[model samples]
Target: MARAFQLAGLLRLRQIEKDHAASDLAAANAFRRDAGERQARAIAALHAVPVEATDASTLFAMAAARASSRSMLADLAALADQADAEVAEAQTAFGEAKARAVGLEKLEARHNASVLAGELSAEQAAIDEIATGAWVREREGNEA
Candidate 1:
């Protein structure tokens, strides 16, 4: 029988940690995409605001609209920046997690290979012993 891997539990924990990090990275990327889309919409709205006005009231309303659009754009830009930072941090975390998991995975592979080799060697030894016994029985029968 093949021996079980000694670090199987630790390997499982590393894999779980890596999976969680991947989820966090995905969420961070989604938030960044959302922030970018909002920023783009704000920019488009700011550009769409009318500059031309026929009267004082219309001019005042236009100014207010442009001001509001600009303020929204600024806020959205800040949000986008924050989202970018979050994505960067998440990517770093994911990379570290992956590295840890990969190391353990490699170790597990080596352990499995060693166990297989041992089993194969034992099987071959048993076959050799059986072959030797058969040869001895045939020779003793011929001598009789």
Candidate 2:
């Protein structure tokens, strides 16, 4: 009975680990997508700043602003690359966790089957003991 409790506790722990892994995968995917969106928005804003042609000084200022925007977009692209790496790591962890969950399920099934077989054997032995005493006929008709 104590062993059974221990086994059950271990199973619960594995299940919790499996759940955490799944969550980590989701978070990583979300972060990757968010980073891409941020980079796209940065580009759009840079493009939206239109250049005016009335004055040479204003035109040069606009050009400088565009250059700055390009630099920022490049930075965002680097961030997206970092996010991709995180997503890949999370995917690996998710695969490992999924495998573990499946393996644990199989192990639990095997343990249950073994326990049932043991109980069945004990019951069968008890039945055999009872039948033998009654069916033997007490020394073929009692003499002592």
Candidate 3:
């Protein structure tokens, strides 16, 4: 009989952790994409603003609008930066989780291979014993 893997339970836990880390990384990437889209929209809106001035008041208003748009752009840029940081952190976490799971998986594979080799060795030994017994019986009959 093949012996069970001693760290099966731990391996399972590691797999679960890896799955969770992957999920978190996906979510972080999605958030980063959304932030990037928002920033793009903000830039487009800023460019779309009309700059034509008909009077002093109109010019002042346009200037104020430009200032507000610049502030909004700055804010969006900050948000995108924060999202990028989150993505980096998530990637690191996923990498660590995957490394742990891979290590355990390799150990499990080695253990299984060892068990199979042992079972095969035992089976071969049994076959050899049977062959030896049959040869001894035939020799004894011939002698008798």
Every candidate's lDDT: 0.92, 0.82, 0.95
Candidate 1's C-alpha runs over 4 A off are none
Best by lDDT: 3
TM-score of 3: 0.90
- Tens digits of lDDT, candidate 2, 57-108: 8888988887888788888888899889988998898888778777778888
Backbone clashes in model 2, listed as residue pairs: none
Q: What is the C-alpha RMSD of each candidate to the true structure, in Å?
A: 1.3, 4.3, 1.6
Q: Which stretches of candidate 3 lie over 4 Å from their true place?
A: none
Tens-place lDDT per residue, model 1, 8-48, is: 99999999999999999999999999999988887776778
lDDT of 3 by residue, 1-96 (tens): 679999999999999999999999999999999999999988888788787999999999999988898898899899999999999999999999
- Quick one: how many clashes does candidate 3 have? 0
